[model samples]
Target: MRVLLTGATGFVGRGLLERMSALVNLELIAAVRKPVSGFPENVTSHVIAGLEADTDWRKVLDGVEVVIHSAARVHVMHEQTSDPLAEFRKVNVDGTLSLARQAAAAGVRRFVFISSIKVNGEGTPVNVPYLADAQPAPADPYGISKIEAEKGLRALAAETGMEVVIIRPVLVYGPGVKANFLNMMRWLHKGVPLPFGAIHNRRSLVALDNLVDLIVTCIDHPAAANQTFLVSDGEDLSTTELLRRMGVALGKPARLLPVPSRLLEVGATILGKKALSQRLCGSLQVDISKTRELLNWTPPLSVDEALRKTAKHFLEQQSK
Candidate 1:
């Protein structure tokens, strides 16, 4: 199979690129903005700079059987742009549709879109997990753009007979992870006491490897056509429990303070971090039964194993 992968240098993309390259039966084409170094023998590169509605994808879509699109303007916590939605739509929605249209024209078999759990809303009620077909309630511009892109892809699939698979993953973490996850690891390394003990919230997270595995599965699965999936490691954890696990993985004692959730929320609001507080003290569980039953797949790695790998990678990077 010939596959074209976008965002090949990104966190998840890099891992997928490496894993796909190891498959002898697959031919990989990486569509990246700039030149990348050290690709495997089975992988080739296609330089497609800026992503926009008019960005030509003729060359990149050539003879590509599957297109795994992982590139998008993700959450900009402190966005400086005036019209954030327009900016997100231009790249996430318009550019994505442009690629899908060109791929359909080029006779591509499948287009796998990597979406986020934010499309289902930031958090759910305590025991109510997000389902694949749940009504979309995007809470931010980035998530709204993803929902719009999903809508467009479904339309394109219906019109052109091109298979489109959507995977909504939650907090993908593993080697080469950055942003909030990285900061948490850093704080853990420093033995900082986190005030998440009293807060109980369930969050679903996927390992980078697990997410890539499911993406590969959706590439050719007949039942995956025009289907949406919610993927995770099949495990849910609270902020305090997650921190404790991280401590175990990092070989550190979990120095967590028993802070009240209300106090934390008020403090965060005063500090202009209401969103962060919600994330730390909210439930965002996903029900991946649809993904498991329809695709006949399960996460290959356990949560503890994934966390250990993540912690090891963090330590290695810090030592370097």
Candidate 2:
């Protein structure tokens, strides 16, 4: 089947690209923001025009059987000015709708949307793991846009008689992982003391490979149409336990300083930090039973193995 993928230059998209490139008899249309270097011969690149306007998605959707949308505006820091929601709406909501409409017009078989767990909430408690049926309560503009996109896609599916599959992954980590997790790994590699030892928060995380596999299965799975699934590593870990395992994966000792949670919260507030402590110290757990029961899929790698692979990638990068 011919597939068109948006955000093919992103973190998860890159892995999807590598996997798709090795497959025979399948064509990949990669829509990217910039001109990428060293793209494979099998893949076709399309630069995204203005996201807000209704561009010609019909051209790219031609002969495309499936679409894996991995492009999004994900950021912790509000670097953009003059309304963040407008920025998020333009790309995540508007662009997604335009693409879906054209994909439907071209009779694409399936649309697989990769959304974040933040669409449920910023954090979850120990007893209540967020499920696919949970009411979406996005905590930030980025997440709000994702929720809107999901809603829009579902409505479009109803109107156009197209198949829609939504998979929400939590904290996906792997090789070439950028942003917060990468920084944390760097700090751990340097043996920096972290105050997360005292926090007993359980966060659900997904390995990149596992997430990619789920997406692949969702592309044409009979059970995935009009279904939303929460995908995770299955193995949940507390803050301290995660740090300890990360240290083990890195082959280094974790320097955890037991600071009071209140003190850390105060410090974070004084420094104008927004949601750092909550993200690090608070819990965001998910239930993946629906995903497992439907697809009979389990994460092939454990958290330690995943962390080790990520560390190895960084080490290899350091050597060069």
Candidate 3:
């Protein structure tokens, strides 16, 4: 099978490229914004300036069987654009649909889109997980754009004969992880006392390898065609538990204080950090029962095992 992967250097995409490149029966092509190195010798590279609605994909679509799209205008802490929704739509919705349409016309078999769990909602009630078919309640512009893109992809799949597999994954973490996950690791390594020991909120997180494995399965799985699946490590964790486990993996102690969740929320609101507090103290669980039953899939790596790998990588990077 010949596969074309976008966002080849991104966290998820890079992992996919590395894994898929090792398969003897598969040929890999990477679509990147600029020239990058260190890819396997057998892999091919195609440079496209940006993911705009008008970006030309005619040349790269030739002889491609599957396209795993991981590229997007990812959410940021402070967006500089005046119109965030429009900016997101240009790439997330419009650009995605444009690529799918062109792929369908070019006889591509499957297109796997990596979406976010934010499409369902920012957070769920304690124990009330969001299902794959849950009513969408996007809280921010990025979430809105993702839901819109999913709808457009579904319509396109109905119109064309191409199969579309959508996987909305929760927070993905592994080696090379950045942002909040990485920061948590740093704080834990430094023995900084965190006030999250009392946070009992359950949040689902997927390992990078697990998510990549699902994408590979969707490429040829008949049951996955035109299906929306939620992906996660079967186990859910509280913020306190997560930090403690991460500290253990790093061979350090997690110095967490038992602060009241309500107090934290109140302080955060006063400091204009309510959103950050919600992420730490809120629940965002996803139900992957459908994915397991339909595709007969299970995450290959355990949470503890994956965390150890991530910690090892972080330490290695720190040494260099």
The numbered model that scores best in TM-score is: 3
TM-score of each predicted structure versus truth: 0.98, 0.96, 0.99
Each candidate: what lDDT? 0.92, 0.86, 0.94
TM-score (C-alpha) between model 3 and the true structure: 0.99
- Candidate 1, poorest ten consecutive residues by summed lDDT: 34-43
> In each prediction, how many residue pairs overlap at the backbone (N, C-alpha, C within less than 3 A)?
0, 0, 0
Q: Give the residue spans of candidate 3 off by over 4 A.
A: none
* Candidate number of the best lDDT: 3
1-320, model 1: which lDDT tens digit per residue? Answer: 89999989889899999889888789999998998788887799989987799999998788899999999988886799999999999999999999999999999999999998889999998879999998999988989999999999999999999999999999999987898899998998999988888878898999999999999888889899999999999999999899999999999878999999889999999999998898898889999999999999999999999999999999999899
Candidate 2 overall lDDT versus native: 0.86
lDDT per residue as tens, model 2, 1-320: 89998889888998899888878888999997777878899999888765544777777787899999888777747465778888888889998888888889899989999998989989888757998888999988889999999999999999998999999999889999988888888888899988877877788999998898888888778988999999989988887888888888887778998887678778888888748877777789999999999988888878888888988998889789
TM-score of 2: 0.96
Q: Which parts of model 1 have CA positions greater than 4 angstroms off?
A: none
Looking at candidate 2, the ten consecutive residues that score lowest on lDDT are: 49-58
**Candidate 3 overall lDDT versus native:** 0.94
lDDT tens string, model 3, 1-320?
98999999999999999899988999999999999988999999999999999998989999999999999999877889899999999999999999999999999999999999989999999899999987999999999999999999999999998999999999999999999999999999888999989999999999999999999889899999999999999899999999999999999989999999999999999999999999999999999999999999999999999999999999999889
Per-model C-alpha RMSD? 0.9, 1.5, 0.7
